[model samples]
Target: MKKYALATLISPFLFFLFTNCNKDKSNTEETPVKDTIVVKIDSVEKKPITTIDTVDYNQRMIALSNNDTTGRWPVKAPYPLPGALLPYNRIIAFYGNLYSKRMGVLGEYPKAEMIEKLQEEVAKWQAADSSVTTIPALHYIAVSAQAAPGKANRHNMRMPFKQIDTLLSWAKPINALVFLDIQVGHSTVKEEVSQLEDYLALPNVHLGIDPEFSMKNGEIPGKKIGTMSADDINDAIDILVRIVREKKLAPKILVVHRFTQGMLTNYKAIKTTPEVQIVMDMDGFGSQVLKRSTYLRYIYKEPVQFTGFKLFYKNDNWNDWKMYTPEQLLEFTPKPSYIQFQ
Candidate 1:
């Protein structure tokens, strides 16, 4: 009697183990694994993460599949931005420091060679895009002035207004944008922005802020450098929003650069602003390879547009340019709308 009782208990335990093992096997079969996934940005199931550097390759796959952008389905989820595409149709290239041409390498300004290099880069991208099926928007960088504390030759970037006019003339005909870059110093955001309001008035003009250069009294961001507060940024945004709406233009894109935590002031506030377009750009300017998968999955997946990038022809070679390319940034199967060429 004792031996039979023991067998009954043992049999039940064995059965449970077999069932669990089988269940796990079934799960394995149901889930597809992937190192990369490609989806169209506007299609359903895009599952775009925040940054491309941080996705885990070993994670089990769950497809977010959408065959066409026009597919409409019943859902409680709010609609994504209309006309959104996987891998955006715009290209942004930075060429900061108009007046620092004489400052040389240490000043971090692009000299004559850099200008030619950028024009070449633009031509190259244009050449590359010629054969593609979809058309992408192009914006050239035009940072205003230089600010290096009490330095004599700094912040003198009056920008000739002539250069801006020339750039504007060139961009308008080609249907490209001219992103005005700002490095706010001891001056207020409104004051600095007022200097370039004319450009913002243009339909294709966008705004870019370099917190790295927006310091006071010789401080650099991440090293006692001052940053623009949320209110400061919003003040600018308010004008932009008004301009875009009143003028009946497209939503204006605002770019805020961040290399570390402190650099970002009031991220939540900036994100929630009404009808404002914002991109939290990673302003890492070095060769140290970084892990991007985390940001892409967590942050890029949010409602706002998240960017994957690098400042090629500048720094951050620790990771290859291939990793930051529009095709590879964020492992986003659908691709990103923005790509930067330094």
Candidate 2:
């Protein structure tokens, strides 16, 4: 696994001070409505049926399978509660943190440039597969794993609310969905997720957890690849389920990042519910052949509810290997419904 460099702006001293002064306040602050806009859904019939239409949802799910002959696809999960974003719309997300340009595409360029680049990717995916509607997304790393243990010695740093507000403001212009991703170093998933309850309650905001930096064994993050068990994932699902039911919001998509078989354990024990949709994302980077082999071994064979493929613009081309085009990825068995660029 490739280790991401630490943010240039987040020094140990600065992060420690920020952690003590603002962590609690940011967690407790009310979610602002000015930056959030209702996501536009395409009408199914003469009337708009974005919310309670099971028939359309089922048909879309089948379409997403891309006529898979294997029984693993379209995992027979529960019909999501109204307002699910999965099969109806394919998500094309730019992943990274606002503080680090080396982290991903989301932070590699200026705000305007980044949005434009994301739009370009969205266009490419739309052209590759016109059957599903493409939704642009900003997959921001809200809680990032840190090389140096800060404040509580958790080896994870939470981005300030101001930074999150900035990302939300950026998303408003493009009507893009925002995902708050967490890479828990020494901290538990429950602890990290509980702090983001207010943000996760929003209709357009989703959740992603990276097992690569989970650090369940108390090893320093980035020194070695970490893992998450089914119980760990179930904890996140349970929290999201409660949020959806209590807030009466639509289903929340939960993305779990994985590249190796050991990164995620007890695959059969992971639970799925109507309130949460899970995507086991292939998060490795390499040559086309290597990427396909990783996907086939871990993502395709594991039989998750939904699958996602990740492309690295720089890393994929390390040995002059070209990145997989959207068309190339679309031809795989159980075509990926979620596509991410890093």
Candidate 3:
């Protein structure tokens, strides 16, 4: 894990159905609405104790085994959005903050230099799997964290629209997608997401929610790893669904970052919709062994519609750290369609 300038800014340790465009909401599976979830405010007692249904260990092993007759756990089924970029191919993203140098490769190098480095990475994946069309992306943190609170009294700082537009411009020449990530701090996902509606309306722009910095209980981000309940996750989904339907555009991709079990709760209750494709990314970095363990622990056990694996160039080196090659990662039961490097 790369450290953030604000100790609280460090990213903390951190799904879907198919339906026709004309499908009726009444006919689809009904998940609990916001009222059902006890939104924890200040204390654990204030937050209702929600129980997550656990999958048996043996079942998880089976899910990880590629012994199924159908073969391949169905590649990105139904495609998250109508004109989607992922699942059909592999998405390789370079994540970081342009304002901070320590965040990722995107910021560590100059613009021309960063694009060159990203193109180099894109080349490696293109060679590794010529069959899969590779798409490059800029994973920008649009809403950053602050050591001291701003006027909102929330430790979050939002980037100006022009700044985001500038970064989006950089991705155009390379034909890359833009992922506008949000770390809500004391704010709610819905509140943070609403502000990015303009960006989300675009086909190439997607969304990422960082639970580590969510700080659901008003604590500053990066202090202690924070958590997001299923209800909170649903808020983002609803926003995307409305945008996709109203704009009459393609489906949107929502990437949720997770490392520990507590980072995200009430996994089973998450709703799936055809308009919004959700990806649960294994955001932890470590030795190959540790990475594999974390992936199996949460990703395998609590399965989502699609899966993603993240690689940290500097941080993963923490423990005898040798990064896993693309071929090595593809060896998993259901190969992850989304891959991110920071």
Best by lDDT: 2
The best-first sequence of candidates by TM-score reads 2, 3, 1
lDDT string for model 2 (62-154, tens) is: 776778778777688888876677786789999887666667889879998989999999899998888877889999888877666766777
TM-score against truth, every candidate: 0.57, 0.86, 0.78
Write the candidate numbers in order of decreasing lDDT: 2, 3, 1
Question: Over the full model, what C-alpha lDDT does candidate 2 score relative to the true structure?
Answer: 0.77
Clash number for each model:
32, 0, 3
RMSD values for the candidates in order, in angstroms, are 21.8, 6.3, 14.3
lDDT of each: 0.42, 0.77, 0.69
Q: Give the worst 10-residue stretch by lDDT in candidate 1.
A: 6-15
Q: TM-score of predicted model 3? A: 0.78
**What 10-residue stretch in candidate 2 is worst by lDDT?**
6-15
Per-residue alpha-carbon lDDT of candidate 1 for residues 1-342, written as tens digits (9 for 90 to 100): 011121111000111222233332211221122211221112111332333221221111111111214222111122222222222333545443333322122124433444455455456555544422222233333332232222333332333455555555544443445666665645556765666665676655777765544565644222343566677777778878777667555556676655444444665455333335565555544322332532333234332343434344434342353325433342442233344544
The candidate maximizing TM-score is: 2
Per residue, candidate 3 scores C-alpha lDDT tens digits across 190-308 of: 99898888778776788998887777677756667779989999999999999999987666889998877888899877878868878888886666876787777777678766788
